[model samples]
Every structure is written in structure tokens, then in C-alpha cells.
Target: MIRVLIADDQELIRQSLSFVLDAQADITMVGTASNGREAIELVRKEKPDVVLMDIRMPEVDGVECTRLIKAAHPQIKVIILTTFDDDEYVFGALRYGASGYLLKGVSVSELANAVREVVRGGSIIMPGVASKALEMFARMARGSMQIAVDTQQTASLQENEWRVIREVGCGKSNKEIAAALCLSEGTVRNYLSSVLSKLDLRDRTQLAIWAVQTGVTADPYGDRT
Candidate 1:
């Protein structure tokens, strides 16, 4: 079963999420926390497969909590759930290695599916949130946001690896990329893993941001793009 922890300041929300998730046989509600501090403690103790995190909390916010969790236990996947989809928080969550961003208003089934997706080593964003996230990224590129990685380091990627990076920037899932490139999902996963290793990226979100920052997807259907 997919182990999950819910962290929300509102008791009602926590209870509601638990009620919805408990109905799924594939998922187990391992624990719940009322604040980021409690969530961090529970995370260290329980080591759940996925964490449904809230952005606002009393002791600590979700962004910092995510950073701590990933730094201490990179294996644990975090999905930021919040009512607000502010650009700073979205970018902050991704930068801190959150597996996904989701609105609390998303259906219970969608939330469960998102948790599964994150557990399976896939990144997800609520439908509308993703478009806005991409738009924020575009603005960052156009503005003065510094590219986080060393360009010289990424200069070693082969043509095919660059292609993989571009595809990731477009937010195509592994299965979609496989079908589009006429490759097996396993092959696509392998290629992406290799790309991440070579480029020293933490996750797909970083890879996608880097691709856009480098303008790798600017040219449609181009080899490097």
C-alpha cells in the first residue's frame, strides 16, 4: 500500500482528507500533523512514502519543511497542498524538491492519484496549477532569475540527452514521452535518470526549469530543443 501522511493546520481538512483517503485500498493513512513542526517530527519517525503538506503553518511553513525533509530523507516524497497557488511558493516548493504542487480543492480521487504518482517517482501538479507554474518559470527566465547550475557542467550532454531534457521541460510524463519518441517507458525512464545524473539535477522540476532557462525548448522539433 502507498503510505501517506497528511499535514494541515485545519482539523476539518485533515479529517476530510483522511476520510477520503481511507476509502482507497491502495493507500493507507499512516499519520497526520497539525503543523509543519509536527509534520517534520512525524516524518522522521514514520518515514511514510508520501506526505501531503500544507503551505501555511504555525511553527514552520511547508517550503522550509520540505527542504528539511528532502535534505534528511530524500526518499520521502512531498506534495504541497494549499488553497493559495502563489508563484513564490510554487517555485519555492519545486526548488526545495517537492514532488508536486496541488490545490486543496482538488477532488479526493485526484489527490489520491497524485500521491500514487509521487510514490511511483513521478512529478505531478494540479491541472490549472501547472500552467501557471510554467508561466511563472517563463517569467523567471525573462527576468533576472539566475540559472542555478553551472552551464559548463551541462555542456557535456549528448544530443539524445538534450532531447530528453527538452521533453521534460514540456512537462510530458514518462509514458507520454515514451509514446511520442517511440521508445518504451523503461527506456525513457533510464534516459531521464541518466540525464539527471549527468546534469546533476535533483529532480525533473529542476531539469524542466533548466531546460527553459537555457532555451532548449525554444525551437519546435529541433534536435536539441
Candidate 2:
């Protein structure tokens, strides 16, 4: 089961989220917190697989909480939950190691799926948030492309690994890649692990950004495969 900790200041929001998430047989709500500090304490104790973080809260905010949580426990995935689409909060959370972001209005199914996706090392942005994220990415790309490219790391990827990187860059899930390549999901996951190791990437999101920055996404996955 996927263990989760819900961190939201509003009692109602916390309870509602817990109710929906707990109903999933594959998920368990291990704890809840009304603030970032409390959330941090709960996390250190529970060691949940995922954290549903609220952006705004009393005392420490979600951005700082995310930074702290990731610094100490890098294995726990954080998915920011917020009613606001504040670009500052979104960028800050991502920079600090949030794996996904979802608006409070998102469907229960979508929220649950986001948690699962992040746990699997895949990132998700709510449908409406995607366009904004893309815009932010485009703005960041201006500076990112100008930065020195690490060719040595680029040279380490094999042809099949490059294909896996491209699929991930296209936002295809592991199962989708497995189906398309006639490989098992475990095999696809192994390919991803190898790709990350060879490329010296932090995670799939970093890999996707590097792939786009390095202009590796221009080629089709089939050709690369």
C-alpha cells in the first residue's frame, strides 16, 4: 500500500482528503498535520511514501517544508495541493523537490493518480496547471540552454537508453513505454534506472528537462529505440 500524510491547515480539507485517499485499497493515510512543522514531525515519524502538502499554512509554509522534507528524506515524494495557482509557489515547490502539483478542485481520481504517479517516479501537473508550467519552463529554458552543456554525461547514454529518455521526455508512463516497446514494465523501469545512472540525472523530471535542453527530443522514440 502507498502510505500518505495529509498536511493542510483546514480541518475540513484534511479530513475530506483523508477520506477519499483512505478509501483506495492501494493507499493508506498514515497521518495528518495542520501546519508545515507538524507535517515535518509526522513525516519523520511515519516515513510516509507520499505527502499531500498544502501551499499556504500557518508558521512554516509548504515551500520550506518541502525543502526540509526532501533534504532529510529524499525518498519521500511530495505533491503540493493548493487552491492558488501562484507561479511563485509552483516554481519554489518544484525547485525544493516537489514531484507534482494539483489544484484543490482536482477530481478525487486525479488526486489519487497523482500520488501514485509520483511514487512511481513520474511527475504530474493538474490539467490547467500544465500550460502555466510549460510557460515557466519556456522562460527558464532561455537561460538553461545558454548554460554550459555537459557533453560527457550526454555521451554515456546508449541507444536504447536514449529511447527511454525520449519516452519519458514525452511524458509517457512506464507502462505505456513498456507496451509500445513490447517490454515489461519492470524492464522499462530498469531501463530508466540505467538511463539515470549513465546520465547522472537526479530524477525523471531532471532527465526530461535535460533531454529537451540538449535537443534530444527532436527525434522519434522508435528511431532512437
Candidate 3:
């Protein structure tokens, strides 16, 4: 079963979400918290597989909570569930290791699916948030992408490497990439490692961001922002 912890300041949201999530046979409600501080405490003790985080909480916020939780336990996945879709909140939460962002009012079925997908290392962004996120990314890259390109180096990628990078741009996990490319997961990891080395990137997150910025994915609409 997928163990989940709900962290929302609103008691009604907390109870309602818990009721829905717990009803899923494949999931278990590990615990619930009313604030970021309490969420951190529950996380340390319960060690749930996934955390449903709220962006606006008293004393501490979801972004900081995600950072702290991921720092201490990177294996635990966090999906921010909030009413606010502000660019800063979304960007900051993901920058600090949030696996996904789901705007409030999303269907419980989709939210459950998101929790399952994230546990498998797949990142999911709500469609509306995704559009705004694209705009945010394009805007942020406009002035800085050229500098990154210059600093990275004169690097060339193989066809297979390009395939992996493109999938990374789409936020596909290694398992998904392997399935898509008809390659073994081990091979996918090696390809990603090679891409990171050639590009002087630290991890897949950087690779994904860079791929989008450099248009390596060859996405015609990436510049729409």
C-alpha cells in the first residue's frame, strides 16, 4: 500500500482528504498535520511514502517543509497541494525537491494517481500549473540560458543521449525512459550519466531545465512564454 501523510492547515481539508485517500485499497493514511511544523514532526515519526503538502501554513510554509523533509529523507516523495498557483510558490517548491504540484479542487482520483506516480519517481504538474510553469521557465531562461550554454562547454551528444535528454525534458523517470527507448534501466542510467558528464550538469533536474532552455528537445512551442 502507498503510505501517505496529509499536511494542510485547514482541518476540513485534512479530514476530507484523509477520508478519500484512506478509502483507496492500495493506499494507507499514515497521519495528518495542520501546519508545516507539525508536518515535519509527523514525517520524522511516521515516515510515509508520500506527503501531501499545503503551500500556505502558519509558522512554516510548504516550500520550506519540502526542503527540510527532502534533506532529511530524500526517499519520501512530496506533492504540494494548494489553492495558490503563484509562480514563486510553485517554482520554489519544485526547486527544493517537491515531486509534483496539484492545485486544489483537483479530482481525488487524479490526486491519488499523482501520489502513486510520484512514488514511482515520476513528476506530475497539473495542466494549468504546467502552462504557467512553462511560461515561468521561459521567462527565467530568456536572460540566462545563453550564459549557461557558454559556461557548459563545447559538447556533443549521441543520438541515444539525445533521446534520453529529451525524455528527461518531459520529466520521465529512468524506468519510463527505458521502456520508451527499448533499453534496459541500467542502460538508461548510464546514458543519463554520460549526458550529465558531457553537459557538466549535476543531476537530471538540471539536465531537464537545461534541455528546455537550450531547445535541445526541439520543442517548437517552448518559446511561447
Candidate 4:
């Protein structure tokens, strides 16, 4: 079963999510928290596989909590489920290793699917949010953001790893990258993990950002105006 924890300042949202998630036979509701601090504490205690987090909270916002959770327990998956999809929060969540970013308006099915995706080491983002994030990524890649790794490390990537990074830069999913590269989904995932470690990055989001910045995909999207 996929163990999940719900963290939101609103009690109704917490309870409602708990109800919806508990109904899923393949998922179990492990715990709930009212704020980021509580969320971190509950994560330590329950050790849930997935956490549904709200961006805004009383003590320790979701982004900071995500950073802390990933730092302390890299095994845990965090999916941001906030009413707002502000750019700063989106970037912060990704930079800090959030597994996914989702709006609170999502249907129960979408929510459940997102949680499952994160547990599978895949990520999901609302299309609108993703597009905006991509636009931001494009700007950052244009030289506004400084890549943390050394130039030599980037030159050491294998050809396959380069392909995977390019696909990631183009916002392709693991399954899509697998199909495009004519490789198995598991292989794509392994390549992604290897790329992250080799680049000394935290997650695919960072890798995607770096790939674009480093010109891995001169035109990440082909034949687009």
C-alpha cells in the first residue's frame, strides 16, 4: 500500500483529503498535520511514503518543510497541494526536492494519481503551472541562474545520459523519454538517477533546469515558434 500523510492548515481540507485517500484500496492515510512544523514532526513519526503539503502555513511554510523533510529523509516523497501556484513557491519546491507540484483544486482521482506517481519516483505538475515554470526555466537557463556544478563534471556525461538530460530539459516524462529513446522505462529512470548523482544535483527538476542552462537542448522544443 502507498502510505500518505496530509498536511494543511485547514482542518476541513485535511479531513476531506484523508477521506478521499482512505477510500483508495492501494493507498493508506497514515497521518495529518496542520502546519509545516507539524508536518515535519509527523513525517518523522509516521514515516509516510508520500506527503500532500500546502504551500502556505503558520509555522514553517511548505517549501521550507519540504526542504527539511528531503534533507532529513530523502526517501519521503512530497507533493505540493496548494491553492496558489506562485512562481517562487514552485521554484522553491522543485529546488528543494519536492516530488510533484499540484493545485488544491485537483480531483480526488488526480490527487491519488499524483501521489502514486511520486511514490514511483515520477513527478506530475498541472499543465498550466508546468508551462509557466518552463518559461521561468527558459529565462534562468538563459544565464540568470548559476549552475552549481563544475564545468568538468558536465563534460563527463555519457551519450545516453546526455540524451536523457535533453529529454528532461524538454519536459518529457520518464515514459515519454523511454519511448523516444527506445529504451525501457526502468532504464530511463536509472539513467535519470545516475545523471542526478553525476551532476551532484538533487532532483530531476534541477537536472532539467541545468540541462537547459548548459545548452543540452539548443531547442528543447523542436519546430516551435
Q: What lDDT does the true structure give each of the candidates? A: 0.80, 0.79, 0.77, 0.82
* lDDT score of residue 184 within candidate 3: 91
Q: At residue 176, give the lDDT of candidate 3.
A: 74
Relative to the true structure, candidate 4 reaches a TM of 0.84
Q: How many clashes in each structure?
A: 0, 0, 0, 0
RMSD, each candidate, Å? 2.6, 3.1, 5.2, 3.6
Note the residue pairs that clash in candidate 4.
Answer: none
lDDT for each residue of candidate 3 in 5-69, tens digit (9 for 90 to 100): 99999999999999999999899999999999999999999999999999888878998999899
Measured by TM-score, how close is model 1 to the native structure?
A: 0.85
What ranges in model 4 sit over 4 Å off? 139-145, 151-156, 219-225
What is candidate 4's lDDT per residue for 1-225, written digit by digit as tens? 999999999999999999999999999998999999999999999999999989888899988999999999999999988555466776777777887688877888988888887787787776657666677568666655656778677666777888888888777778778999899989988988888888898777778788778677675432111
Cα shift from native, residue 95, model 2 (Å): 1.3
Index of the highest-lDDT prediction? 4
lDDT of 2: 0.79
Judge candidate 1 at residue 110 and give its lDDT. 82
Residue pairs in steric clash, candidate 2? none
Cα error, candidate 2, residue 180 (Å): 7.3
Candidate 1: regions farther than 4 A off: 139-160, 182-184
